[model samples]
Target: MLVALAIRDVVLIERLDLVFGPGLSVLTGETGAGKSILLDSLGLALGVRAESGLVRAGQSQASVTAAFQPPPAHPTYALLLEHGLEAEEEIVLRRVVQADGRSRAFVNDQPVGVSLLRRLGALLVEVQGQHDQVGLADPASHAGLLDAFGGFEADRAAVALAHRDWRAAERALEAARAAIAEAQRDEDWLRHAVGELGTLAPEEGEEEALAERRQGLQQGEKRAEAVAGALSELTPRDRRGGGNPAAALRNAARALERMPPPNDSIQPALILLGTAQDALAEAETLLARLVQEAAPDPRALESTEERLFALRAAARKHAVAVTSLPELLERLKERLSALDAGSGQVVALEAAARAGRAAYVAAAGRLTERRAAAGASLDAALSAELVPLKLDRARVTVALTPRPEAAWGPDGQDRVEFLVSTNPGQTPGPLARIASGGELSRLMLALKVVLARGSPVPTLVFDEVDSGIGGATAAAVGERLAAVAARVQVLVVTHSPQVAARGAQHYQVAKSVTGERAETSVTALLPAARREEIARMLAGERVTDAARAAADELLAALT
Candidate 1:
């Protein structure tokens, strides 16, 4: 509910601070007592369009502040959370209008846009009047109002969940289709590549091993022929073996031994020949091993070189190191498999999609039924309220249009709008098109009275809703307003004493002059003062004893 409103240098109101309370609160005074000015100031503070003319004479700027107290579970709390703002018990909305016709808005002392303030204001307080008939004129609020009236939060939630499920399924289908299309685009390339890699059958480290072997052989090939040549020079090959020099010397020693018992010079020759034979045998053994090792087949070297070159080129083509060639081949093979075998997978996914969509539609259909039922109840309730408000000829209806094709929305694809017929023989049309200013206010009141049990907004204000009402009909409007206030806070600006008496708190808006400046002032009137004010509303500028007594009696009846 609105707790306080402060205005400074705003038109007739030079400086004013008005505190409000719960239940029906009525503001009453004589004609030109500045009631309209007060509501206008409130609207400006709530982010209404600003005008320089609203500024007080000789003032540079005009400012207004409105404070509201919302319930703990109010939707405004969630809205604040969504926008990264804090939510507390009290939210203060302030607006500053400059003489240049520019304005600034603030909520909780944080700078905000006027549109945002207006949106938040709507959830906190609903203002209905001749100019702003938001409550009845807007069809967007009809479905929500019905849901609130019927306590269908769970149903609404189910619709939301179904919507989420449907969207997720749709995303999955799209992703699968995208994958299939990409695979088809590369089908031919994948098949040929898969065949080539399979034939090559590359092992994890095969490229490096092949390259190393090929390099060792190439280097060994260069040296092999030279080594053979060197061996030929050391022991030249001929048809008759080239006899070892030391071995022949040893044979001469054998002959010397046969000669037996020689002199000292012969003994020295024999020793030298024996040493030469031993050296030749060792040399022969080493040369035999070296010849065997350097005799690698030239054909084997060529084969290894070819294999290594193929592996390296493939690695470069795939943008991978020789060592990563195996992994790259495996990935390409997998892509081929997907393309070849995807028909079955696609069929399965299509089936699953059908099931998911069917489930969603089923859930949405159930929710639609409940919403339709809720709309009916709201229509009946509002219709029941019309007779008492002197709108017996008016017809109230909730129009529900279902679009199965577009029905996959967060709120079940049903477009809910309010329709009305203001008089007999008139066809019902959209509320905004059919209801005139006075009719709109009364219809809004009727709908509100139906949903007044626990509305989202904590405060409700009607600016001259009794504009076309008088006498008994005015009293009935007062009774309904009072009834709504019992559940939430209501502030009504009226010239009817019947309505003023219905308020638990009565305020008087009057024009007073001080210090050469004429200004508007607001005062919270006590019982006696309230009676005098009510009497002024009842009779005229002159207050009579009978009128005051009648106001008191009306008050007595309200209690």
Candidate 2:
């Protein structure tokens, strides 16, 4: 509830301090007593749009501070914590508007944006005037209000949970469908690639090993060729060389033996020829053995080269390194496996999505039924309240419009609105569109009285709630205000004596001219002053004995 309001240099209000309590408090004075100025000051502190004209003449700026002490569980504390502001037992909202039309906002003495101050102010107090009612006027809040009145917290939570599950399952279904669609687009390629890689069956390091073996075989082949060439040179390929060096040497030695039976020189030559023949034979045998040892199998070399090329070709085709072929092959095979099994998985997810949606629909349908019952109850409750406030001809209807499937939300599928018909045969329409300003204020009063158990705002301010009515009608407004005050704080700026007489606390807003300046002042009225004020309201600008007596009776009746 608003504990204090401090205003300085604001239009007619030079300086004023007012303390409020947790019951219906009335402010009463003659016309132009600056009662509206007090509300304007409160509005300024509540983060309303600031204007330079609000500043008093010759004052550089105007400032208003509103202090509130809300309940421990009030949502305002959560709002404060969310904004990284201090959340103490007391919250002070201050606004300072410079003469140049600039303004600053503060909460708990910490600087904050005007927007945040406005939001916090909304949570702390709701100002309902002849022309404006905060929470009650907004359609978006109507559904939540109905739900609160209906005590559907548990039902709403269940519906919300079911909604989330449905959405999650649907999202999963979409992802799986997209995956399967993508996989099908490449199914042919996947199968062919898997088959080709499986056939090659390349090992991790086979490429390097094959290349090393091919090189060794090529070197051995070169060494074998050189050895064979040497053996050919020792045996002459032409007949001029006597078919082989050893054969030619043997023939020469035999010829020397025949001619040298008695010649000593021919004997020495034959001995030299025999020695050369034996040396040539030994050379041929050594060369032949080296050739055999160095020879490489042609088929082995060819096979190594073919295997190396095949592995490299597959790497290029697949855009992977030769060493990565084994890993790539396993990955492709897994993709094919998933493709084959994805249909069953997709079918399972579809069933899950269907079940989730069905659950949500069932929960939402139950909530809808309960809301219908609650709405009927609310209609009866509000109707009972309107008649005593001089709106007996007015009828309130709690309209529940069904929403489409796509538009369904956690609150269920109904759009709740409070509709009214001011006359018997009039078609019921939206509250704001159907009722006059005075009627609207009274209707809003009845609403507050009905939803008193559900409204979270700790303080409610009504400006001229009895603007166009008087006598018993005015008294009825006062009675409802007091009733609401029983549960929360209420403040009213009124001219009706009946309404003023109902206040537990009374203040008289008056203007006084000092020198050339006119300033507004508010004074808390005692019992004697309260009677005089109510009497003054009853008999304008006069102090009559009868009015005073009537005021006494009025106060007495309520007490």
How do the predictions measure up, each by TM-score?
0.74, 0.73
- Clash count of each predicted structure: 0, 0
lDDT of 1 by residue, 166-261 (tens): 777777777777777887898887777777767777788787688789889888877777777655655635544455454466579888887745
Largest TM-score belongs to which candidate? Answer: 1
Candidate 2 per-residue lDDT over residues 326-388, each given as its tens digit = 999998887777689889989999999999999999999998899899999999999899988
Q: For model 2, how many clashes?
A: 0
* Best lDDT among the predictions, by candidate number: 2
| Model 1 lDDT-worst window of ten | 236-245
